[model samples]
Structures are given as structure tokens and as C-alpha cells.
Target: MSKAAFTSDSLESTFLAYTRVLSQYREYWDFLPFAQFDSGWSEPKVAHAMAQLTETDIEHFERDATALYQQMVVLFPEVKMLPVPELRTQTRPEVPFWLHTGIGGRKLTQIQAFVATLPTHATHSPQHENVLEWCAGKGYLGRFLAFTRNSCVTSVEIEARLCEQGLAAAQKFSLSQRFLRANVLSESATIPFSMNDRAVALHACGGLHTTLMTESVAHAIQAVHIAPCCYHLHGEGQYRPMSHVGRANDLGLSREALKFSVQGMVTGGDRIARLRQQELSWRLSYDSWRQVHTKDHLYRPLPSAPKSLFQGDFATFAQWAAQQHGLTIADTEQWQPYLAQGHKLSVQVRRIELIRHVFRRVLETWLVLDRALYLHEAGYKVQVELFCDYQVTPRNMMIHAHYLS
Candidate 1:
């Protein structure tokens, strides 16, 4: 409920608070739901209460994280004292009428909100006269910025076709924009960032955004505006904290743990939910059957199958999955019992995930705040805000920083 923007000290305090709470309550969110059958609750009353959770309760928690948190507070009285910081919302951007051709409704809205949330052209110093758009897809955001601002935009993208399309659009509008087709991760990609450049990335994946941050700081870029996504997509196998504070309070985030941060169900509707449920149920069923056949209780992860596979019966999906692991489904195998068992396991997993899902945003906040603290440590005035509603995109949080030195 606090409207005050996060300063360096405040950001550190909030980050530390989340770290402490997560560390304290690691039992709830620190494990994979499918990997373990046990509820793992130490409190007898809390365990009894959670064990009684029905499908409806799981569905409710799936939709609303705050509701789950409130319920958790009621169940575990000690967690009521946990310090949870609320991110301040930014003013909604006014979307001007422009030829927003080919852009989807969701994407256009995200671009508008992102652009308006940034500092205006008048607010930029002479050093921030130029803009570098990292991983720009067709340079839509860069083109929009060029249309609205006086800054020359350099859009960097890995794909040549996208760069060509973006370049064509920029040329058509006679905007001060150009596209560079180069892998931002490659050491020899030859990016043209300078001290006068203000780096901007919209929904850049893990390594891409991290590259922008490191490159910007190294080049002494005047400013950086980034909304990062896909925390698990980084090239590095494990997470390495960027800021000193984060390193000091390291949660030892694994790839699976990072993936858990983005498993929120905000935009997906009933069909998506149904598909997800079917997929999980089938996968769990296969795992259950495999455990008995091999006499091994350890969890074995299956490679991701196509949506078409889920459309078929569990028998078909299991056969396909089994083939990949050099196993065969015997003709006499009773799939119905395993399927029933899978459904039961599915419910159990979902109930366990209900409590774990509450920390998705908290983990996300820790991530972005770590980036902000890194900028703060590098002598930048950093600010983090929710640029749009969670419904628009769960990855709506933005970090804006400018060199003060």
C-alpha cells in the first residue's frame, strides 16, 4: 500500500526482508511439488488444514496470490509478522493514436506503458541523446520511440529478417532509427554502444538483459531502462547474484527455482488451465508407472512434449514418453489404475503448489531488485516500479536508472 518509490537503502531493506522471509519459510516453497509426495508441514494443525484443501481451494489460490498469503497468515500465525513490501504502481500511460500495424493488442499496450513510464526526452541529459534497444523484435519499441522522441535509436536484434523489417519501417517513416543484426551475447558481435547511449530493453530474456546491464555499466552509458523476463533462460547454468547485498544474502537459486518464479497464472484462461492440468496429470501418471516398474522412487523428468500429445489419451502420451527413455509399455499394463493414480497425484501436487506459488512475485522482486541494487552500487540513481497491471503481464516490473556521477 506504500506509494513511495524505492530508494537504494529502501530497496536493500525490502530485498533483505524478502530474503529473511524466504529463508525462514523455505520449507513451503523450496521443493518441487511433483518430486515429493509428502506435504512437509511441521505444524500438526497447519498440516491437517492443508491436507483438507480441495480442488476449489487450489483453483482459488492459483488465481490470487494475495488470497493465498492471507490464508497462510491465518493458518500460520507467525508468518503474520513477515515484512512484505508492496511495489508502487506507475501512472498508466496514455496511448496515442498511431499506425500500430501488425502489433498485437497486448504487445502494443506493453510498449505504450513501458515508453510512458520512462523519463521524457526533456529529462535526458546530452549524454543520453542516443538510445540502444537490446534484443529489439522488429524494433517496434525503438520505432515508436523514434516517432515520439528526438533521440536516434539503434535497435539490436539477432535475426536478420526482423532487422530488415524494422529497418524498412524506420526508413518508411524517415525516423532516426537503424537495426543491427548481431548476437548480443557474442564477444565479437561488435555492438556500437557508447557513453552517450541510453540502453533500453523491453522484456529481454535472462542473458540478454544481463548483457545490457554489464555492457551499459562498462561503457558508462548515461541511463538504462529494462524490463527483464525468462529468468531461467540465462546461459549460465546457475544464478550468480549481481549486487553485493544479493551475494551476501544469496538464496542459492537453482534453474528449477528460477523457473518457479514465473509459473504464475494471470493471463491464461480456462482452456489453458485445462490443457496444463491434463499435461501434468499425464506426466505424473507416467512417472508413477515408471517408479513401480523400475522399483525406483526417484523422480525422473520427461522432456517437453508437444500440445498435440496432450490432446491424445494418457496411453498414447505414456508410450511416446516411454520410448524416449528406452522403456516400453507392456500389452498387459493396466493404464486405468495408473491414470487414476496420476489424477490423485495431480491433485496432491496442485495443493502443494498453492502455498509455493505465493512466493512467485517475491522471487521476481528479489531478482529485479538485485539488478537495481547493482546499478545503485555503480553510482546510479535507480528506481523500480510496476509499469502495468499484473493482468497485462506478470513481467511488468521495470528498472530505470541513470548515472549520477
Candidate 2:
């Protein structure tokens, strides 16, 4: 079958773009990446550069945030011009009211989007005998498949509670679904697959989704639908590319750099945005304070704190950080200039990251392409596309691979 136009140049160009910015701002982004300025003002040179950021520059940075984002879109245009595929229109099955009893709104919407898109992807593949939901959380996606699609469903999840919950829900609905408790990372987690098995996974983080792709080939499963997320969660420090093409192009992504790929938050509401900014400001301030007394400009990642800390003034937050680190900062005023520097650095970080955002999706596609190309190399026909709008989830790219006789 002739596939719609999807090309490697997009990922290649984006990866090149990502490499350029990463190289250009290696020190700046590595230390002050993500607008959090992970490194405190310990390096005199780095601090010196930030200290020179005038108030006018900060105001300009703030004003141009939206414009910079628009410029990013123009620079790296989306190339996944996917042809509209056929979707299941038979009926929307009754979503058991109990199924959503404890699920939050965001999770529910994600589930909805996953279920809505699954059928369209599944239809494009050769008909298979069963559905295997990888890293299935309460088997929500598999449950929808079992009830709507005429297939036996097997849900695999590590959590016993989720297994129990999914099993109970399946029985209540009288659907053909079963839950398997297995640590996906273990050797024993391989699902017994036949060519008749079709698998699906939604937002499987890092190596979890990659494992599914490899297992599908190892077992010769007929089809797979996977949307990967949380690239930073991989056990390895650097991303090991999959396909030969992906491997050939040395767009090495470190764990810290991987965080930038999924850091775009254009869809969040104003309040969520403010809270995020506030959180980063306090954390940056803490870094600034630590740099002065401890003489360590290293970026120290703090543990989870009460929301009250973020609610408090910078002075109180600095004291909390000092106390937490067993350092007695007798005079917080001395660190005031450092805190001011941190804020200035945040503005600079934001502006630098706007350029990084241009390459975010394209780099993601390159990674996704590596996974797809790996599947293709393993003898499965693969298709990759944006499964939903960014509003639904920024990590919305889906990879569908099918094996035909």
C-alpha cells in the first residue's frame, strides 16, 4: 500500500537544528536550561554574563515570548501531512460510570484521546486476534477495545491494585479482558505473542515503549500502536538511537537535553503557567543563595517541598534552602544580588529555550522515526504521525507497525 507523504528530512533537519542550539548554548542551557538556571551563579563568567542583563532586556524577553514561539513554528514547519484515515463510526460504547470513579479530568481526557485514536490506527493494520495493552494502567485503552472491537484483550500492568481494578471492571462489563501482573522491565515480562496478537500502548515512557517494539519483533506480533512519552525517564544517561539511519546520524541526546524535548507548555492555562514560573523562580533563587554561602555553584536538585514554600517570600525560601542544606546563612541580604541575578538569568533562559522549542517536535519525530525505523528493520511496515493536537498532549506522536504475510 502506498503510504501518505512522511519524510526523514524533517527529523534530520530538526535534529541538526537541535544540535546547533545545544552546541551554541551548551554552557548557558546546561547551566541555565529550562528557565530554571539549574546552576547557581558560581561560575564567575556565567554570573557575569547574566549580571549584564538589563531591565529593558528582561522586559523585551517577556514581550517577545509569544513572538519567539511563532518564529519557531515558521523556522521548523511540521511535515507530517497525514492523510485522514478511516475511523470507527459504528458506535461509542458505554464507558462504565465506575471506570471513571477516581480518574482525574486530565487522565480522563488522555484516555478519551487514546481510545478515539486507537481504532483509526488499528483499522489500518491487518486484522489480529487479540489486543495486548503494554504498561496498561487500569487497562482503560484495552477495556475500550474489548467492549467495542471484537477482540480478546490482555492488559499488562505492574501495579497489583490496577490489575485488580481492571480485572473487576472487565468482569463488571462482561468483556473479554484479562489483566496480567508483570514488571515490564524484567525478562519474564515478554508476552507470549502469535501473529494474531495486536498490541497498543499510550504514552509509554522511555524504554518501556522501546521494549514493546523489540518484543513485537521478537515474538512476531502482527501489529503495534505506541505513543512514547517522558524521554528523560530512560535508565541510560544518553539516548541510544534505534534504526541504522537514527544511529548513523549522531544527534546524541543527553538526559538533561531530553527534558527540553517535552518542555513546551503552550497549552497550559494562565494559572498553571504562573505557578510554574513561580516554582522555577523560587528554585533559581535557592540556587543563587546556595552559591554565596556554600561556595558551590553546582545545581543542587531539591526534594519536593510544601506549596507553602513557594507561597512565601524569596527571603524565607532562601532560609529554608539554607536550613535544609545544614548551612547557616546569617545574612540573607548578602545573597540579594545573587537572587536578582537568578531572576535575570531566568529571562535569558526563557529566550534561549524559545529557540530550542523550534526543534522540539522535529527532534521527537527523529526519535520516533528511529523507533519506527527499528520496527521497519525488524520486518514490520511502520507509519508515524501526530495522533492528536498539542492541546490534548504535547507528546502526541504515535507509531503504528504492522506485519503482513
Choose the strongest candidate by lDDT. 1
- lDDT (tens digit, per residue) of candidate 2 on 280-358: 7677777777776678867786767787777768777777877778877676266567767777656656544554454
Instruction: State how far residue 173 of model 2 sits from its true place (Å).
Output: 1.6
**lDDT per prediction?**
0.80, 0.65
State which candidate has the highest TM-score: 1
Segments in model 1 whose C-alpha atoms lie over 4 Å from true places: 1-4, 64-70, 73-96, 123-128, 187-189, 195-197, 321-330
**Residue 62 lDDT in candidate 2:** 40
Q: Clash number for every model? A: 0, 0
